[model samples]
Target: MLGGFGTLPGKLIWPTSVTTSPDGDLVVKDSGTGHIQIYSPDGDFKQRFPYGFEPIKGMGDVTCMRSGVILVTNGTRIIQLFSKDGELIHELKSPKLTWPYSYGITVMQSNKIAVSDWTDGGKINIIGVDWRMNAILKTNAIEGFHRPVRIAVSKNEDLLVTEGQLFGRFQGCCIKVIDKNRHLKRTIGPRYGKTFSFENPSGISVDSPGNIFVTDEDRNYIVMFNPDSSLSAVIVSEGLQGPSSLSVMEHGLLAVADCYNHCVKIFRYK
Candidate 1:
């Protein structure tokens, strides 16, 4: 039985990423508190993993695998693997990454890990890590990125990136899809201009049916699109204030991290 949207005792301070483990446990990255919080499927507190080698430091995104291993970024181009019991197992460092602020991470079905390195160079760095958390292959800096924030992998192993850059008083954001070989496949959303469409697209995830869902932070809604880049529908257009991250469950259930609202909203898809 599904218990409605569960609440956290303390407010989630600057929650960045939320994902489910292979056992259906909910894991959240609290950037403000610089730690990862785990919750059981029933919304009970499991445990908290501190950042750095110290306790309660700061961390970036968190991605979990089916085998119960958790991957977290330290915002310093370093990825740390933690055991199911919250013990640091392994750590991998990226020397090419000078600026910390690496925002997004996704683990493929094959257990390969991919992360987005956001820097001032205006390029997106795609780093592929092996099962041991060692950087095996990396793509050249893909230019034309203002602020690559989030990333998602499709069923076909394609990469989708969200670019969020503030322009003037407005935030210009868009999504770009890349092939497995790190080639630009297609660009979604409006072209770069004054009247651009997306406003700070922060989160992205693809459903099993090949549908893409993105959280438009400024618009306060979740936008869905077909695999071919066509708009499908707006899942939620209201009752959202600064939706940051999202995770799609198995049975058409959607979870949106409502940042300003300080809660994760669970919705059943019809």
Candidate 2:
């Protein structure tokens, strides 16, 4: 094994996503526990968000604000923002919001965010950092967005999303890039060949060089794409069970949320 597995002081179950805060702490959406946990760069547990709900309830993705606050998705309709010390800062929710399901989340410049949906034909929700619901990006979000499952903001500030499954069949797998206006800019998939394709892509991240890393759960691999969206290489191809999420860090450190393995895997990339 190249990357060491870490459960830290407390074991995490079914971690579906992993991200990094501005300060370099590992932020993981502890899906099985219905909470978010923070860890030091070296795999030491630091803090856990306040998760008043019981385990087995729905808890979704997580992202970090430039202010170092953590933003976590609660179910399909709520966003819980909290400080680094685990204090609740704000909750973004509305009864009238019609997003049937929530999947990916990306923090944009100027205190904006774009959240994707799980529905086959749904739009990405754009909201302000102040909890204001902004415009929903719907025009050609992507051609085959069966379930836009993960998202990341590229170095150019564009949106990168991964399609997870088609009608819950674990069939769709590809990466889509969208401009700031939500227009589809590029679709990288099997059309580029098996080496460039994915199987059940569930997580995505972009490094400073605009390199894209994606986790394909069904295939048990993480593929990398160059800044121009060309297939760069396969970071991992085996010994991984249900790799659900990934986060690209500085100095070529990559974090993988091995869902079935029940631990986080830290890998080296460059």
Candidate 3:
């Protein structure tokens, strides 16, 4: 309840994404005002990155890396690297990206960054630490992605991306799992809810214990999928405007962006 309707320091207006710094500060990217606001552990506004920093005009997502540097998406075109103290360090973009925009990004311990392109059949590009665009990950249309969005990397080296939004008589949403070898492991979709299946699972994260946490945007709840492929629990099922994005901290705290509600909700998911 730290942020809600209002124009103040800690108040948030229609935030689209939430992530945590290495030391546990909450980093939120608001599309409403196009500002990246960092809050202290106790919810005090610590730093702010103003709008217009991106030549493209808005910030998309914020991912705080282990080195304390923050990687921010331009909403389209490129991802910019910024220092924890709020200085723009560098930018990560590839001349080979045909789509030009990235809505999702994840930094690996191996110094590689995974960027997602939701357009044109769905592609995830891997970039080296030196900032060279490596490879557009090899994925079969059937085995891996149909329409990909947010992506997460697990401790066991599995890359999970939200895949769905297919048209036709066959309609459903699922999480596509890829291993270290870049081979498709399996696709896990919504199956256990009593009233509805997972509708518009936009954001996903894999916990240390191999459990998966996903945000069902249309349903306004967060679903926990166990490693055994079973539904564990559903969080904030009521009063959520649009639970679209989620981030799991190193210490296991879950940060969810309640899109339409104009706030971010933090949870202790065990």
Question: lDDT (CA) for every model shown?
Answer: 0.70, 0.73, 0.71
Each prediction's TM-score against the native? 0.83, 0.86, 0.85
Clashing pairs in 2: none
Write one digit per residue (lDDT tens) for candidate 1, span 1-270: 111233343346656677778887777776666667777766677787766431223325677877888888756656788887889887777566544666677887656666666566345555555665355555445666666777788988888888765554343378889887778898887543233378778889888887888888888978888878888777788998887788787678777777666566677664
Ranking 1 against 3 by TM-score, winner: 3
Q: Please report the TM-score between candidate 2 and the true structure.
A: 0.86
| lDDT (Cα, tens digit) per residue for candidate 3, span 1-270 | 557866576677777778878888888887777777888766677877854444443225678788788888765666677788878777655565444656677877676777776556667766655543423333222233555667888887678887546443224477778778788887777556465576677788777788889997777888888886577888658877777688776656788888788888778875
Judging by TM-score against the true structure, name the best candidate: 2
Where does model 2 exceed 4 Å of error?
Answer: 1-9, 52-59, 131-144, 166-171, 194-196
Q: Which scores higher on lDDT, 1 or 3?
A: 3
Error of model 3, residue 31, in angstroms: 0.7
Supply candidate 2's per-residue lDDT for 226: 90
Model 3 deviation from native, Cα RMSD in Å: 3.8
TM-score of 3: 0.85
**Candidate 2 lDDT (Cα, whole model)?**
0.73
The per-residue C-alpha lDDT of model 3 at residue 143 equals 32
Q: Candidate 3: global Cα-lDDT?
A: 0.71
